[model samples]
Target: MKRLIARALRRLGWLRYDLLISPVAQHPGKNAVPPGELWLVIDTGVKKWACMSCPGGCGVQIALSLNPDRRPRWSVETDFWGRPTVSPSIHQHRACSCHFWVKKGVIEWCR
Candidate 1:
């Protein structure tokens, strides 16, 4: 039933696999995140965190620091269409251990 609804949404151009940026003043909790969406927490013009759900379907939320001062940090770029490309790839060390790259809003899994 759910799959059918998803397919219908896809057919209607409502459901997409691409990642879209949702800027927020504050970082949202994991439960508030939706799949195929990236949340950018911007506080006073500073990019603080990039939050998103694991595309691996493990239901784990991944948050990457955007601070260059931090040892482990990531950068995000978006095209005119608002499709996001995350640099340095993402590797989940725990949970599902999914590693992938987000380029032009597409998920390229690391094998």
Candidate 2:
């Protein structure tokens, strides 16, 4: 069933979804990670650099550092909501296979 699949994916750490149990503003200066140029080092050598901006519309650039030695990493660019967030983008969207990750954190590189 769909629920079973979601659970399995979650257990594997490949899926993420969030309900705003608390508002971003509630944490104020605590969770005040700026939207753009956000870098998350998920595990030991896996790092993700996300830069987001809005000129007329939102744009997101995501880069992955897959190796500990590599300073120059591969990158991709797309619209906002490129990853799962508390607020989903009105522009880009989730694919059927990736809907779950969007809600933990997901998107870009056309995977």
Candidate 3:
């Protein structure tokens, strides 16, 4: 019964972005990344990476770098409540081809 209810909720766009700060180096696959939640990994007070599952429901984990020194890196900004807002946009050139922006805990899909 609970499983069915959870599925229904997920289908109803229950996705919301949440923040998580981790110390050790880790990959998104090494963690349980639910839908609609973006994991922002911070190492030594510096935001290093952001990751989340594909909002397209393809189950693909998208990992983005936050290092400014690195080319093609995304930046994460957190509001007073700790909600995350990502800059530019995420373009998945892979099979899923999912492109979207996470602004203030909302996913904005690009046309």
Candidate 4:
């Protein structure tokens, strides 16, 4: 099955996610984010938001607030290799309800 193959590829470290930084303050359009890429929005040197397409294969875009002053905000840290680690798991309350954590560019799906 495709899911099994994907898991195998992940285990073999062939599959990994990437982070892309954008200085534009506006929200990314539906097709702006490519698969396996997370976009970080920065405005005037302030971290604004993180955007990415849903990993659940539903093609929905998810945006999380990066401002520490806002409630339910998430923080992102990157290693020397530019691999990102996001604190606190991301849980989609609607849609496919996919929940996961991004650590070092790897998605750890939550059950």
- Measured by lDDT, the strongest candidate is 1
Candidate 4 lDDT trough over 10 residues, lowest sum = 15-24
Q: Record all residue pairs in model 1 with backbone atoms less than 3 Å apart, i.e. clashing.
A: none
Candidate 3 local lDDT, 1-111, one digit each (tens): 533454465468673443322223555666667765677777777878888877787777788998999989999886644557888899987778998888866778999
Off by over 4 Å in 1: 1-17
C-alpha RMSD for every candidate: 5.4, 16.1, 6.1, 6.7
Model 2 lDDT tens row, 1-111: 544565566679775532111112111223333442233434443334322222112333322343436655433332232333423232334222222112334322223
Task: Using TM-score, rank the candidates from best to worst.
Answer: 1, 4, 3, 2
lDDT of 1: 0.83
Comparing candidate 1 with candidate 2, which one achieves the higher TM-score? 1
Each prediction's total of clashing residue pairs, residues at least 3 apart in sequence or on different chains, is 0, 7, 0, 0
lDDT of each: 0.83, 0.33, 0.71, 0.75
Return the TM-score for each candidate structure: 0.82, 0.20, 0.73, 0.75
Q: Write the per-residue lDDT of candidate 4 for residues 20-71, one digit (tens) a residue.
A: 3333567686655777667778888887888888888887888889999999
Report the Cα lDDT for candidate 4. 0.75
Worst 10 residues of 1 by lDDT: 1-10
